[model samples]
Every structure is written in C-alpha cells, then in structure tokens.
Target: MPPGITTLAADAPTLSAANTGFMLICSALVMLMTPALAFFYGGMVRVKSTLNMLMMSFISLGIVTILWVLYGFSLTFGTDAGSVIGWSQDFLGLSGIGVNELWDGTTIPVYVFAVFQLMFAVLTPALISGALADRVKFTSWALFITLWVTVVYFPVAHWVWGSGGWLAELGVIDFAGGTAVHINAGAAALGVIVVIGKRVGFKKDPMRPHSLPLVMLGAALLWFGWFGFNAGSWLGNDDGVGAVMFVNTQVATAAAMLAWLGYEKLRHGSFTTLGAASGAVAGLVAITPAGGAVSPLGAIAVGAVAGVVCAMAVGLKYKLGYDDSLDVVGVHLVGGVIGSLLVGFFATGGVQSDAKGLFYGGGLDQLGKQAVGVFAVLAYSLVVSAVLALLVDRTLGMRVDEDDEISGIDQVEHAETAYDFSGAGGGAAPRATASAPGTPAAPTNKKVDA
Candidate 1:
C-alpha cells in the first residue's frame, strides 16, 4: 500500500461492533424504562386516575424524542458554552454528524450515543409526573413536560455530563444520573407540587395504591433496565469498568431492598409489597451515580442508607403538606443525594477516575466537590421548575376542575377508564333469578356481584 493510504488507515477511527451493539441494546433498555415508570406510577394512583397516571409518563417518550432530535441533543452534548451549556451548529437537528462518527473518544457511533442520552432525557421528566398525578390536566401536563425538559433537564444534564460541563470539570463522580436525572427530577417534582397544590382530599383520604402487582412489575422492570442505565454509562465493557459497574448495581440494589424491608418491619411491623417495591427503586436510584466509582461493599452502604433515608423521607409530604402524590421527592431526590455524596466517602480511586473519597484517604476535597454538584443541580432545578410550573398554571390552567378531579382524571382527561367495570357493575346488567325467569325476576332481592 502507498504511504498516504497506510497513514489514512492508521489515523481513521476504528469502530467496535461489540460496543456498538451493546450501547444500542442499552438504549432500548433505557427506553423501556419510560413505560416501566408509567406502570410504576400508574399502580400508585387511585383507580379513578389510573390511565391518566400512565399517560403522564408515556407522553415523555414522544415529546422528548422529537426535541432531542431537533436541538435537545445539541444543547446538551454539543461544544461547551462557558461551562454552563453546550452549543454546536453541527449537532443541530443531528444533521451534520457523519454515519460513522464516534462520540468524542467512544467506539460507538455518535448516533447511538445521541439516542442513548435521549432516553435519559425522556425518562427524567416522566419521573416528575408521579408527584403531579391525579390533579393536572393532560394537555397542561404535556405542555409542562415540553417546557420542563427544555428549560430544566437539558441544561442540568449538560452541567453534569456534557463535555466541559462545570460539575464534570469540578470532579463530580456521577457515572450515570444521580444529579442530573434523579435529583433534578425530584427537585422539579417538589417545585411543581408546591405550585399545583394537593390532591383533592390531601391527608383526609386513604389514597391507597390501586394495584400492588403493577407496582412490583414496574419495579422489577426498572431493576432490570437499570443494568443498562448504570453499567452502559461506561459506554463499553472493554476495560472491565462497565462490568464492575454492573456488579455494583446489583449488589447495591439487593442491599437496598433488604434494608428497606428491614426498616419497614421495624417501623411498621410488616414487609408490605409496596415497601418492597419502593425500597428496590430507592436502591436503584442510590447506586446510579455511585456504582461506577465504588466497590460492591461500598454500594451496599450506599443502597442501605438510601433505603432507610427514602423510606423515612416519604412521610415528609404529610408533615409539610405539599402532597407529593407518589414520593418522587423522597426516593429520587433523597436517594440521588445519598448516592452522589457517598461517592465522596466510598469511592475506591480505581474506577472511572482517580478521585478518591474521604474514606479512601482522599479527605474532604472530593466531598466538597460532590456537595457543590448536588446543591447546584438541586437549587437550580427547584427554582426554575417552580417558575415554569407557575407560568403554565397561570396561562393554561394546570389543574382540572374540582368536580372533575373528584370524579376521576382518567375519564375527564383521557375519555376512558383503566378498568371496564361497565359490563360487571351495579347497573350494568339486570339481576338473574333462580326462580321462574318469566315472573319479572323481581321478588328476588339478592344483590348482583358487579
């Protein structure tokens, strides 16, 4: 071969088919999480608002996908803009990227990276929906998602994960999305619920979950998908970092589940299914940021701490009376903080980067950096999300009418009910009699089982 041809071949980037396949699968797994969240949040709401709850999460998959393709990806992953946001004309509409272009230093195609990140963008806003369940108008909710992702999620994601992002430069150790996804969504949930006010009855109502089975299923799916969410964030498993992350994710989640059940058994005297499901999710959230940085043992600590902290935090809504309908603030916000901060203590100085946590002899320096990343995302998301919620509320009317809310958001918003009780209900069918059928079937006063 000619010298020029040989040099060209040497300089050209090599694509890893294995890594590409892995990331693509990971992207699909992350995408599955949005619908999984739909199920999780759906099962937590009253029967009257079940479909509405599901739709709130499912809508994000549609809205965020379009935005990400257009400019969301650019605003997030493009060239650095003053350490706050990203901007690159080549990334606008994702039009200028070549088919084989890799993401900075990664082996997978940039498109794969874009789609993978897009899934994260999709799921974050869906998380906030749990807090707003059973109250907001569907159209208003959809609009809020559009505005929230644009104003809040994109910028925060950039700050944490984008190239030259402030937190990334400050040495924050978010391997996945503890700060960007969970805390951001959790804080945003608090902001919106504070603005939107409580569900109709507030603390007076029972508000028990309509279906524990659905919640369990959703939690199970989240646990499965999180392997991709946490492990795949390493981009590839070639160096064993991703494999270690995968292992840490599992260890932490198991520890968290057991810890949460233990807390419930001690505090409430029973290991309820809801508690089990919630505990598992708390574990998943706690390990998301810490998994890549900590050992399996450290992950256990992170998971256990989050499980107990979140279990207790869920009750704060009652004490403070803000009405976070589904405990997004408790699990995501608290768990995210637990994972992010613990990295300052549990980090092994062997994975992701050389940064060591306090326990590893790195001292308070890394802890301080983690603190900045945590509070920065928290404060920004809280203030801005509240403002946006207020904007949407004033103009478009965030809540449904009082009567509509009392009746059911599913019927009012979606024009359908989650369960078709019509055929089996009180007035659905005439009572059948064992006596003479022709005798009007009237004398029998037995109630129908509808």
Candidate 2:
C-alpha cells in the first residue's frame, strides 16, 4: 500500500463497474423504446389499423435482433475499408469475440456493446412505419425493412460512427443519430410513401387517431426511453459530458413541448394532446444530435425552434399533395435537419469535441460539415429507399388491395381486430356509436332503430 505505487496503479485504465452497469441500464431503456414506438404509432392510426401498426414496430425487434447478431453489427462496425463501410465479418452471430473481450478502451464486454447497438438497429427502421400507417402490406413491410437495414441503415451507420469513416475523418459530429436514425428513416419513409401512394382516403376523408390517451402514453414512454437513446450514446458514466447530455435531453424536450403547445394555441386557438406529444417527439429528435455538444440554453433554443418548425412542417404534406400518413417527413426530417444544422452553430468545444460552431467563433467550418452529413444521408436514403420500395412493390406488392383496405387492415391483413365494434352476436351487437361526428361508422350487421 505504498502511496506512489497506488497512485501509479490508479492512473492505469482498468475495468469500470460503474460504466458497465450504466451501459447495461441504458441498453435496456433503449430496448423499451421500440414497444413504446409501437404504442405511439399504434394510437395514432385508425382503430382498424391498431394491431397492424403495433406489429410493424414489434416485428423490427424480432427481425433486427437476429439480423444484428448474424451480421448487422459486423457490417456497421467491423474493420473499416476505404472509410465508406466496414469490411470484416469476424464478429458475425457474436462469434469472433471472446468471453473476456472488451470494447476497445472500455471495460464493457463486446457482447454488451453489441446488444446495446442492436437496440438502435431495431428502432431505426421502425421509425418509418409511422409514415406508412394504415396502408402497407405487413409482409411487404417486413421484407422491406429487412432489405432496408442491410442496404441503407448499416452502411450509413458506418459512415457516421465507424473508425475511418469519411464523415468521422472530416470532423463531422453526430453524437446520437440525427443523420443515421431520424433523417435516414424520415427520408426513407418519404420514399416508400411515394411508391406506395396515399391511404385509401387522402384529402377527402377525415382520418384521425382512434386513441389520444394511448398517444399520450406512447409519448411518455418515448420520453422516458429517450434518456437512454440520447445519453447512452456516450456509453459511459462520466458525470461531465454525460450529465450535460442528460440535462439537455430533458430541457430541449420540455421546451419543444411547450413551444408546440404555444404554436397550436396561437394558430388553431387550442392546445391539443396530440400537439404536445408530437412536439415532445420533435424535441427529442432535434436534441439527439446536438445534446452532446450544446449547453442547456442552447438545447432550449434547438428544441423550441424544432417544435415550431415541425408543427408548421407537418402541414406541408397537405400543401404539397404528398400523402405522409403520420407526419414523419415533417417531424423527423425537418427536426433532424434543424438539430444537425444547429449543432454547427451551437456546438461548444468543452462539451465533447473541440469543434466550435459558428456562434461559438468557429466560423462555418462545423456548419458546413453538418450540412454535408445531413444532406448526404437524406439523399442516399431517399434514393435507395425509393428504389427498394419500388422493387418490393413490383415484385411482392407493397400495398393491400382496395377491398382489404376498405374492410379494415386489421381483419384483412392479420385476421384479428383491435377493437371489436361488432361484438359476437350479429343482431344485437353495438357498432358505430352514432358515427362519432366526422368519422365513418364502424360496419356492423345489427340494424339500428331509426
């Protein structure tokens, strides 16, 4: 127990129990986001499409877990080749790594790192399901995601985070995944929407969510899980940068929620639960990239701007004549761009990287880098996703038939219903409940007494 000897030993890096435990908890929290996403999108669709919507997000957990274990992780993080993609398949199916294998400089095992990233792989494609709500074929969507992650997401993940990645080489910063996850998925969603066409009823039909409470619940779950999503990207328990990320995640999200409410009240003369949930999500997406770099006040500005811009952007689908079913293009695409760009202006040298944004006297250096990353992912995703969607549509059929669509995708696609408006008995079952004003009545065999 010599003092100098102990000091020397302490200086040497060793296994960290605190960091390991932190990553594990963060991994689990991120895992919850998928199911939470299911609920979020599920509640926003028609009652007839509830199960189908849930299944879309739920299916990703199953599909991506197996895929990531098989080779998804390898292609994304393996030995980098030419800085565009990872080349080694040594870790496929969790094979090459050993029991004592640690992730580079960290005490966390490679397996822990693998599974933590797997949650991200699962969630990215699921984000697109919201845009295609109430229309796409379940089987087609299943296949499309499988192809998409392999072709689009994996490579893009490398470009942003992998060793020797071009973007990494250029000093581009994406602490979480504004480019890889939100912008990528958002662009891909718009691509698929273009190929698949609109929901059966576009401008004419009054389509609304079946359950606002459920939407609120899902948003709450997303906000809860987002702590892991944003903060866990740091992958350690350092109180300095990690703590700042945690605070910024919360601050930005709260500001965005309030900003959205204010915008709603001013424009529509009413604040809505849907606006609150959507704004919170917009905040979450915007902060995902900038949280690690910006101050708390900076985060507030990012979130508030995103909240207002996205709220207004959602209406673009209507004006532009594109059928974006759930405002994915609006919220995710616009919000992601806002966050990514703001990082160029708001980034501080002390937080994580030495890169300072324009406002911090770094000039437009980081801003230009951010723009390149943003549009690069957006363009690549948009083109590739469109091609993939068209291929799926041509070969296997992307949308359900008109008859099945009108009959409710739940019963038509899954042979199950979310809510049985037409109970069991044919003659006396409760159905339609007076049509709920603008909504069409639920079809039932029972005759109503006029």
Candidate 3:
C-alpha cells in the first residue's frame, strides 16, 4: 500500500471501530427496551388482550426501524432547517454518513446514535397503545401508528432533538426525553383513549393484570436499559459519564420507589407489587429530564414528588371518565411535566449549562422557562395528536369492531393466545385460526355503531 494512501486513511474522520462497537452495544441496549415495553405493558392489561398489548410494542421494532432507516432520522436530526422541521439532506439513504463519523462533536458514530434513537422512537408511540388496550382494532392500530409517527412523533422529535427545532434553540434542557418521549407519548395516549372511547366494562370491571411477574420483569428491564437511554445521550462513555448520570439514575429511581410505596400504604392501605413497578417507572420518567441537571439531592426530591403526584394523577381517569387504560397519560405525561417543571426549580449544577432552580436561588425566571417548555409541548402534542387521531379515524378508522373487542384482540386480531395451559401443539390450544400464520387473530369486518 502507498504511504500517501495510508496517511489519507489515518487522517479520515472515521470513528475508531472500538468507539463504533461501544455505540452499537448501546444501540442494542436501547433497542431491547421495545420488547421490555411489551412485557411491561402486556402484563398490565386483562388476559383477553394481553398478546395484543405486547404486540403493540413489538410491532414498533419492525415498523419504526424501517422508518428510521428510510427517513425518520433525517427528519429528526438532519441539518439545521427551521424551528418547525428538518430538511431532506439525509434523504434516500444515509449516504455520505460513515460508521465512526461523529455526530456534531460526539465521539460515537452517527449511525450508532441514529439507531439508538430509533428504538426510542419505536417505543414512544407504543406507550400510547396501552391507553386504548383491549378495544382497538389491530388493523386500525397498525394504520394509526404508521400515520401518527409520520405526523406527530417525527415533528415532535425534530423540534426537541433536531438542531432546527424551536425547543432546542430555546435552550430548554430535555437532557433525555422529558418533553420529547414521555410528554409526547403521554399526550398522544390521552388523545387516543378519548377518541377510541373506553373499554367495554372499564369502571365496573375488575381489570387487574393477569401476570405480575411479567410486569416486574418488564419494569426491571426498562430500569436497566434506561441507563443507556439517558447516559447514552452523551453518545459516548467519555468524561464523567459513568459518575454523574449513573448516580442520578440510581438515587432518583430508589427515592421514587419508596415514595410510591409509602403513598400506596398511606392511602390504599397496602403496598402492592403493581405500585412498586409503577413507582419505579414514575421515578424513571421524572429523572429522565432532570437526571442530567439536578444534584443527587435534587434527583431524590424530583423522584419522590413524581411518585406521589403520578399516583394521584392515575385516578383522574375515573374522575374524568376518560379511559386511559394503562395510565400512559397519567404516569408518563404527568410525570414528564412534573420533572420538566421541577428542573426549573431544582436544576443547580449538573451536565448541561442550564439555569438553577428556585431551591438553587435561580427563582421564577428559570421556573417560568420550564413552564413554557412543558405547556408548549403539552399543547402542541394534544392538538396535533387530536388532529392526527381524527385523520386516522376518518381515513383508516380507529376503534375495533365492538364484537372483536368484546371477544378479545388476542383471539380475534392475532389468532394467538398469550398463554397455553393446555400445552397443545405450537403452544396454546388451537383456537379458530385466522389470516396470516402465527399472526394474532384480527377483528372480523363487522362494524359497530359509532
């Protein structure tokens, strides 16, 4: 080989393969979250639609992955375009983008970062599906996710993470995904539940989950992978990445867990396993935005407060008569807003160069900024989500046929059972087979009166 050629190769801004490896691992770690989400959400629903709930999160693995590779990444993190959306410079393909080439100034490969973020994009919308569980049509849901992602998820992601996004330009500190992932998912969930209507017997039915163990497993995976989700935002293991975010993650989650259990005991008279899992998730959501900003003490406060607030918020479904079946709006949206606003009051000295909170003596200026960020995200998400819901309802339709829903999405939509007590061939006892082998049974085309 020519010496000149070797010199050129060395000089090229190629990311060291080692760095690429780390990022790919991180990406994989992040991707694991979607399935974990399936388990988390699947275990929360009634046994009838359990498989449908799990599939809701699982389908994202297939759908969003394709979208991200095609154009989702470009629309989100492409070059600086406008406060509204990104340009198509990254169109058709990831052309000119090299594995190992850094994004902005980060040490990891841009591809690695893109794929990792892809997992988050896949999971965020899946989170909303839980709100309308057991009642939505499988085909309608497939169509809805496709359309919703193109309109709502993509634009919101661009605004928060993309350079040209308005929120990014405003210096709002969303360290992880307070506004983008949690708030966006939460608001969309609320819109979906309202539009789809409630479950058949929402208030009166004993809708407890069938599998607490699965819920525990899902929550554990989520808590574990969250380190990558949040810490990996740094894009590399460089600097004090291990110390700062790690401590914040641990402390906040623990505090939130205790706070949630404590509240459950105080109010409901029993500290249930469900509350434990929910509390952990609440802490994770609360700390997502604030973890990189607040101190350990701040994280503790944030987590504890989030646990109590979300616990209270979960009951709103009963009060308002909106069936947010899985508490997506309650835990994620409410928790996200709490953390986002609290950071304005608790943000002292952490990773990003943001203002201090009220406790840190920064006063109302930062708090107001936090409020602006929260309300802007909430209002935008709600309006756009509602509009998108209306579009899907009109175009591809939204809710499932009433009979299909009453019979259960797992039996009607997927044609597969969540469990096989009979241990028949190929798993569960063979029920009536439907279209698409191994696919869940879908609803028959008989429409119910809207």
TM-score for each prediction?
Answer: 0.93, 0.91, 0.89
Write candidate 1's Cα lDDT for 242-332 as tens digits. Answer: 9999999999989899999999999999999999999999999999999988999999999999999999999999998899999999999
Model 2 lowest lDDT segment of ten: 428-437
| lDDT, candidate 2, 8-56, per-residue tens | 6466556678888888899999999999999999999988899999999
The alpha-carbon lDDT assigned to residue 57 of candidate 3 equals 84
User: Could you report the Cα RMSD, in angstroms, for every candidate shown?
Assistant: 5.0, 8.5, 11.1
Regions of candidate 3 where Cα sits further than 4 Å from its true position:
1-19, 424-450
Clashes of each: 0, 0, 12
lDDT of each: 0.92, 0.91, 0.82
Clashes of 2: 0
Candidate 1 lands at a TM-score of 0.93
Over 4 Å off, model 2: 1-12, 421-450
- Runs with alpha carbons beyond 4 Å of true place in candidate 1: 1-12, 424-450
Tens-place lDDT per residue, model 3, 1-450, is 346655455454545566567667767777888888899988998888899998888887788878877888878777757687775665436776854468766656677777778888988888888788888767777777887787878888888888868887777778888998999889888877767788888899799998999999999999988887877776666667545777898899989889999999999999999999999999999998888788888889999999999999999999999999889988999999999889888888545665787888887877787777788878887878887778778877777778888788898888998887774564544366557777877666556698
lDDT of 1: 0.92
